[model samples]
Target chain A: MRNFFVLAFVALTALALPSVAMAQSAATSAASDGNTSGVITVIQVDSETNLVGFVLSTQNGELVEVSVNDSTSFGLENAAGDRWVSDFGEDPTEALLRITDQRERFAPVTVTVADGVASAVVDREQGDLERNLGFLFAIYIVTWAGFFAYIFIVSRRQSDLAREIKALTSQVG
Target chain B: MAALPKIRLIWLGFTAALMALTLWMVFLWVPTEINQGNIQRALYFHVPVAWTAMVAIVLIAVASVAYLKTRDEKWDRLAVAGAETGVIFAALMLITGMVWAKPVWGVWWTGEAKLTTTLILFFIYVAYLMFRAYFPPGEQRRRLAAIIGLIGAIDTPIIYYGAQLWERAHPSAVVGPYSNNDSSVDGPVGLTLLVATIAFSVLFVYVASERYRLRKQEDEVMALRRAISLQALRVATTSDSTESISSAPAGGA
Candidate 1:
């Protein structure tokens, strides 16, 4: 029964991720007018003019410009699978600050385009991940979990044998 | 009686520290890959566990050979324990590899050379365990298991060289000094992988040793059961003789 549960857990985790990502992508596409997905190749910050945004290298080898403004929304999947969103609400600098704070350079993102300008950049890479820290945690979890589970099974068997030894020794005595 | 609590505690502490340091280095310190991104980080733990599995196979072969030569049950017990531990690590290696593959290779599994060989290796050890179960406790079982173990050891090298020998989807080694592909990993990434390897190797040793001790306990239990049964038979036989003698005079009168 315990083995069944473990197998179930692993199967669910393996099967759930792709669909979760697909659902997120579908939702984003449904809500937005035009969505273009690409890898962020450049970020230009000009404090002098209060302008800050990034450039994305699209799959078709096109370079698209994205600027953060007050109406712009920033969101990424956290390590716990929670959607963390920050709407700068017309403060382009605030939106840029949030992006810098949350994202690594060159991360893949899906940008919502409106009237030839980028509105909201959804991180496609982040959505694919279980969490920012999830992949690393998973590595550790699988390692330690497998180790301990083996130990637990061994210990149970050992206990049974030990009990048998004790009973047989008593009988002999 | 063999495993000292203090020593186990110390090793546990060290393992925990090393594991934490490795995790920190991997997540916070190592640079993310330009292509694979965070998924590449899985390599740090995956490769190490795979290496541990290979090492465990080597140990099993050595122990199996020693058992065949010396006929020491201890060696056979050690071989079984090692294989059990190896199976755990091999499973981890396969699962982690699959998880990493989906995002990077775009597939959950492939019948590529390295992957196929690894799957075969896993089955061989699993078969080792099952082979031990089919026969009763005796020379035949031990010798047969030892021979199978020695034969199974052959696959480890084939799996290791599978990527290089075949034009396969799996990449060549990237973290070790002896790795064929040097450009696959950067300095910090390589160092993190090295540390992760060390940590997993140490954990393997600890787990395998514990398994060996447990197997020994099991053997002791079986021996005690046999001894108790023999003693019971002796007592029953003596009581029957006394009863027969006591009734013989009455029958004669």
Candidate 2:
């Protein structure tokens, strides 16, 4: 009955953990979206580099050039005066608009817009199984060694019994 | 105890032949998967290894119970062999799973049901072996180990159903009935997996039987040595007594 409670507690704890993690991640993503209204200005776009340098400007005219990859989603106006969200996948050579907020630069910062918006970025990292393979392999080897070691130890213990049997046999002869 | 027939050579030949045929079917005969490409080929090995591991554990439980009932050391030896082989095949399943996970699931490890359960089961059996090692030879040791084995076998079902319990409580990403069904396992993939499973099962039986035979042979040799020593001791004592009686009469006269 005590074992039952212990198992129940463990099961309950395991069941609760992932829900907590999911809730935490959701809250975190929600909190990070508060500053989404900052105006993004395109500065320079390189066709070959697939890099779109853009400046994020607040209402106060502060500018910071952030390099966005081909996978970045940017809403832009084309030469045909049509609004479209362009990314690297759809159009490789779309024109990008340079926006200036009354800066002291004579030249307009040039940026190029790609064809389609980046759908979703999938990041692949070294996972636990691959990273811990060496450790797991070590554990596996140790476990197998323990198995054979058990056999050897058992055989050694039985050796005493073998001796006892030998003594009895010698007496019988 | 009488010696069991030497079927190891025949099993070896059969396993080799089946393995060759399985490889031929997997590589040459089976067509590549349209969706998952070449990586889906790993399913042949992964599924079979998992199945074989399950079989090995069941065998271990059976042997453990048999040993307890009969007190035959052969059953104990078979149980150990089955557990050892089960662990090996379970590891293979895990490794192959990781290999398949990289391409398919986009992650090498997940807190998924089958994988985690199998991992826990593997560790449980490892602990079982450890428990066996700590105890000395006797009825108590055998009985205790057998009881643990039975309990461990019972846990297998819980591990298997953990996913279902979790799914009931939480919203899953791949929702809907039959959303992730393997509709693509029509032709070669199915055949390859079936063949691999059969071959591995045959291999498991062959290895377990051979280990049991070796253990029985060791016991027989020990028994023979004991008998020989007893005969020698009896002859020596009888001769000593006869010499002592003859010498004592002469000394007295």
By TM-score, the best candidate is 1
- What is the per-residue lDDT of model 1 for residues B1-253, given as tens digits with 9 covering 90 to 100? 5567578768766876786687667656666553344556677888899889888989999998899899999899889989999988889988887666544433456455556666779999999899888879878888999999999997678666774456455442221111112237647877888998999888887788778878888778878878877888898999999989999999999
TM-score of chain B of each: 0.88, 0.79
Which tens-of-lDDT digit does each residue in A1-173 have in candidate 1? Answer: 24643664465346435533443333322222266667767677775746466777877899888776666655544444444455556455555554554446455676666765556555565334344335545665676677767867876776777787778778778
- Complex DockQ per candidate: 0.14, 0.03
Candidate 2 local lDDT, A1-173, one digit each (tens): 22432453355345334433332333322211112223454556566644355455543576645555555443333334343434444554452332232122332222222332222211111111223333333332332243344434434544555466567556555
> How displaced is residue B158 in candidate 1, in Å?
4.2
TM-score of each: 0.67, 0.54
Interface RMSD values for the candidates, listed in order? 12.2, 15.8
Report the lDDT of model 1 for residue B172.
26
Residue B208 in model 1: shift from native, Å? 0.6
The parts of candidate 1 lying over 4 Å away from their true place are A1-139, B158-183
Each candidate's lDDT (Cα)?
0.68, 0.55
Query: C-alpha displacement of B60 in model 1, angstroms?
Result: 1.0
Each prediction's number of clashing residue pairs: 5, 12
Docking class of 1: incorrect
